[model samples]
Target: MEQRHPEKRNDRNTDLTSDQNLKDRPERQESDKAEQDPGERNAIDSNPGERKPAEPNAGERGSRERNRGERQPTERTSGERQSVERASGERNPGERNPGERNPGERNSGNRQGNDRNQRDKDRNEGVADRHEPVDRVAPDRMAGEIAREGRRSADNGSSERQDRSAGERGPADRGTADRGTADRGTADRLVVGITLGDYNGIGPEVILKALQHNRMQRICTPVIYGSMRILNRYRNILNLKDWNLNGIQNISQASHKLTNVITCWNDQNHEIQPGKVTTEAGQAAFACLQRAVEDLKAGKLDALITAPINKQNIQSEEFTFPGHTEYLAHEFGVQDNLMFMVSETLRVGVVTGHIPLGRVRSSVTRERIVEKLNLMYQSLKLDFGIQKPKIALLGLNPHAGEEGLLGQEENEIIKPLIKDLREQGRLVYGPYPADGFFGTRSYRDFDGVLAMYHDQGLIPFKAIAFDEGVNFTAGLPIVRTSPDHGTAYDIAGKNQADETSMIQALYMACDVARRRKEHQDLEANALNPKQVVEK
Candidate 1:
């Protein structure tokens, strides 16, 4: 866990100008006199008539006498000497000194000084009370300590309260405390498999950047399915020479403390032509994906986060699918799956994905839409922990077919399906114009949106959340997610690719995997209400 630093407060110079400080420390007054402008001091001595004829208190008189002893006395007439003695309270005061401040002014100045000193003292004490040790500590322990201190400061609370609060809320709040409990829990963190996408592209760059976070290891152990040599090439290019990865040939040798890399290939002299599409790069990408998927399917891994891959170059005799989603769907033997785009605020799943724009019209069937909807619904409940999810469907044509005049798909196909689903008690609505839906930001009204085609959903989703979106295959039995981007041949190896989407994909994969396990546990442990009542 990343540690937080407490802000340091500078309070050593407090109360320097307070009246008590000036009276008790004559040296401070002497320093003030020494710091005064020499011309101003000379002017005061040269024109005694301009000096304030204030009657000095005994303390002030003693300070002045000591300061005056360091310099020659100014020549004055006998009358002026008597007046000065009278101002110094040596004689009866028949008349008040002209330069003496009134009692109200003295009292106000003293009050202002005292108020400022009190405020500074209070601020310093508050900072001291809130200050934590600067050294590194576990985040959960730190959070607990902070909470305890806060409660104690709130009302002289007992240690019992602190202990109880920490016990009740510490794990839930920090998430670090709960990593030690059960299977894939505390004893062993969830091992997430990350397949390095096209080596020539920005995959290794982003993977390295995302894994550099300190919190990544605390939550789960990451195993990179690629050659360490390839990773080192990009690591050197990115100038992350200081960053290290634990290289191992198999998962058995993976380390929990460091990022583990499995050498999927043995080739050391493979040419790495970055920013260019090459068959070798595609083959290498496929090799990494195949190895990672094998581990994932064999239950050796908890989740899989695939980096961006080039759809065209990755095609081979063994891998003929258009993209990772289709390939994973086939590998897992799922006949149909939803290509879902996920972000913090919006979720969109296309009814027809990776198909030509011409084929999209024919693919917009009621069954396909219903299939994607069910997948999205289950994903929301089991993977996202949402109890009831509302879904919106985008129209195939302009103005939602304008009452069947512009197009018949929305009126003949989409509207009927939505009506049937609503009758079946599903929170489904739409056949809405895609333009107006996103233009008016109506997607915010629903939990998810079902687009009729690829661009209908992605064009807007990417525009809104390009940096943080994750493309998740919704119906897969195993968790699979990837950054919502492709191999940017233009910017590959430039070290300018943003890693936000990759990090988000990793986070979503782990979160969904954990949620699925929790859901399965709940289903397995579900109690029979009637049997319980009889007992």
Candidate 2:
């Protein structure tokens, strides 16, 4: 306001000066013609001081005023100025009219519209950022994040909100809308095949006991792949009538509906007694596993969870595979097979399996070690839901050779592998001695450990997680997992075995199945972005 006064006053003063300056025009005819108007002549005669001030440039002053009035002001009236700005903003879009709209209203309306559009644009941008993929993320952890987000959004207190809604409906008569968009589909019916490891062991007993709980029905439609007679025999021995087991020939027989009962797949036709280790029992267990793998290959079963299998028993004249994991690896034609033994606290991945102890040092290579580390990382991601997994490496020597004082395996080979992996931006550590490191509290600092051989890892792993360890096969095209402990023939049919590991294997299998599906979906989306579009 203060700055505007000088401009207004200057215009007034210039007008006065211009009038007086017109008194001394070079064109006497034009000057006298102006004086002929009585009002102009009287004003000029009365204001002699003003006339004297402008007498030097009368014609120039009159012409300059006429030109100045032709141009538009950079800023107009307080109200028209706003119009000029808004109109200038929109004015360049096309032509303009002198009287198209009232200046004040047009400015305010346009400003309001611009503000609203900017706010909406910002809001939409914020929402668009929520769906972008976090690169290199683990599959299970991504699922957990999705589930937690869903649960968080469902807990919006809509029930309490309806209490104060004051609608026509009574407050006490509100339906249960509390669980909006919750984990209903997440806890849906997933079909998983549980293959009894070996009939001579606790495989049959654990399968029967694990199905006794009704809560398992809520998570998945579990199917026992062994004989019906074997399953019922264990059920009879346990004396539990809560089997709730449905006999199905294939996936078609089992209901694909949600919240369904457990389905038992009767694949074999052999009658075997408990505490017996015969060739017939071995063949029956093998056939059950075969059927289960066939279904898995055909996409009928999401994943296969083996209870336990004895390597020696599976080594009949007809059957000659080391264990369930190796046999499945061979069946699936898997080359990059990694055996991951998992406890609640620690997980161990074996670089080489079932080889002689003498060959352990030679089997550890830079490429093989690197591949094992990569598999362990991916397995921890998909199977266990671990994000940013940290892996520890165990040396082949006694004390990691005290820097090759006892053996040069760590210094010659393992150290180079560690350097390359670190350079590749992977989180990996150690090459500590096998026994010394596994026996200490340092195992807690890692997500998985790479052991040189089988017993080097299994000894401490089983000591810590005796009954709860689960063996997970990594880098397979499909999800394959099993119980960590072997088939126990001593306690077979005795009903003295525990089913905790078997139950964990089933849960882990289901989780891996979901993860595999999710990973496939992500890959599909990445390959064809047009398949997914926002509304």
Candidate 3:
């Protein structure tokens, strides 16, 4: 061979083209059929030390592969360019160099990331951001979705005045909310579940009286869960019972004559003789309460208003439950409960309810009193429709123990609880010797009282508002209102059982229902989206 200079070996093909071709090669068909092929290109570019062979069609190998490679970017669609930047780790078209970014593309990603971070910050702060975290949606928020803003602290004085506009505007805004809830009732009157207390008592009479009015029909479709036999007796006594009782067995089980109807469930025709006190009557009364509780649980009844029951009667037949208050609490699985008397002037809640005086000392703790006071306050506002109800807290000791000289309970127990309640914005005042406070008609000013003992609140309560007071179970899941009196056995047969307490109970039920209807409407709207289309 003629002597060739080393400089000539670096030809046009070996210089730029060879290095550039190194970027893409191999995967050639010439490599596969080695018998018929010579240029057997390898797919994997070997390390500099060793070059692997027969990598056919690898690394952009073609007649004009380099030209095609140069043309790839210009030929790519915008979406493909974006995808290449994403999947192939290619730089964005505008800035494919270090220490720089494509302004438009970079700005787009920056804006999205910033929006996501801002949404997260707003959620933690409870701000109403347009975009929210999926997990932080109120429905997905851990149970107990309390109002995040303007929360009423447990330590402020309640009488501290809010803006007059806030007070005035609440109802005006509520008008819209109430209109929302009315959708269900207007379509079909609200199904009101009424439970008769003691059939032998005045449970049957009150129902006949309360339902005879046309107003109840306009507001609710009243369903009484009791025996048809007793309802018949009530209708007969009122003469309108003879007129057109329009009474039925079940909601779906109505007769032709039972058209504008009184709804009765699971009708048992036990002979109901007025003034007759028997275990059968007791069992029937007990059954009625149980049935009403089941209906309330099943959501068939919008609200339940119970009549007076003889405590002795409900406690009979091994149902030996203390009374309706305890029995209903047990039935509905409610642990925290209190007996409240709701009247126009004042509300009274018994601390150690239905238990004897001896047990009062042990049961009436500062903690229990404080909790009861809080519940009472909330209940008065929510259930009784009281606005900023004032509360009078009584002392366990007579003359409030003359300041611990006579007894230590007033000083040791009541004072601390009152202070705690007062700190929580409750209008609570007393340890005022029970005698002087209630004796002077001072309770009249307050909306409610938390008596240290059951009899302490009830004695004065019943004495003044006997026939008018409505027995209420505060802090319960369901609505329960009844007459605060016992079955008047003395006047049971005389037709002289003054229906005053029963009437009060009916009115109380109506008032509570109306208010509940209003409040539920407010809460539902605040919780729902703007566009709600019912099916």
lDDT of each: 0.73, 0.64, 0.60
Model 2 RMSD vs true structure: 23.6
Q: Please, what are the lDDT tens digits per residue for candidate 3 over residues 1-535? A: 2443323422421333334434233532233343233433332233323444543233323312322323332254334445666675766443344334322345456545765564445434422212111111121221112212112211123212221222333454645544444454345344566776667776676566555422243334566777666776666665543223445555544221112344343445466667767766777677777777777788766667777676765666547777877777877898878889866666778788888878889998877887788789888898866788888877788787887778898888888877876898767888766678878988778888878777788888888888678888888877778877776655553455566666556555655666676788788877456566677
TM-score of 1: 0.68
**Weakest ten-residue segment in model 2 by summed lDDT:** 128-137
lDDT of 1 by residue, 442-517 (tens): 9999999999999999999999999999999998899999999888878888989998898788778867876777
Q: Model 3 segments beyond 4 Å from truth?
A: 1-188, 213-215, 237-242, 252-269, 316-318, 527-535
Model 3: worst 10 consecutive residues (lDDT sum): 131-140
Alpha carbon deviation, residue 381, candidate 1 (Å): 1.0
Residue 73, model 3, lDDT: 29
- For TM-score, candidate 1 versus 2, the one ahead is 1
Model 2: lDDT of residue 30: 55
What is residue 44's positional error in candidate 2, in angstroms? 99
Tens digits of per-residue lDDT for model 2, 1-535: 2243433544543544345425333554454455467755454345445665646233333333332332233323333453466566765212334334433345556655765554345333422111111101222344445433322322335312321232323333322331221234333446788886677678877777666533344345667777666666677777754424555566557642211222243435555566667766666677778778888889777777887765666676645777777778788898778988887798998888888888877787877887888899988886667888889999887898799799888888888888888898888888888767866768999999999888888888888997878888898887777777776777877879897787777667766777777777777767566767779
Screening candidate 2 with a backbone cut-off below 3 angstroms (N, C-alpha, C), the clashing residue pairs are 21-54, 21-58, 22-58
How big is the RMSD of model 3? 26.3
Note the clash tally of each candidate.
Answer: 3, 3, 13
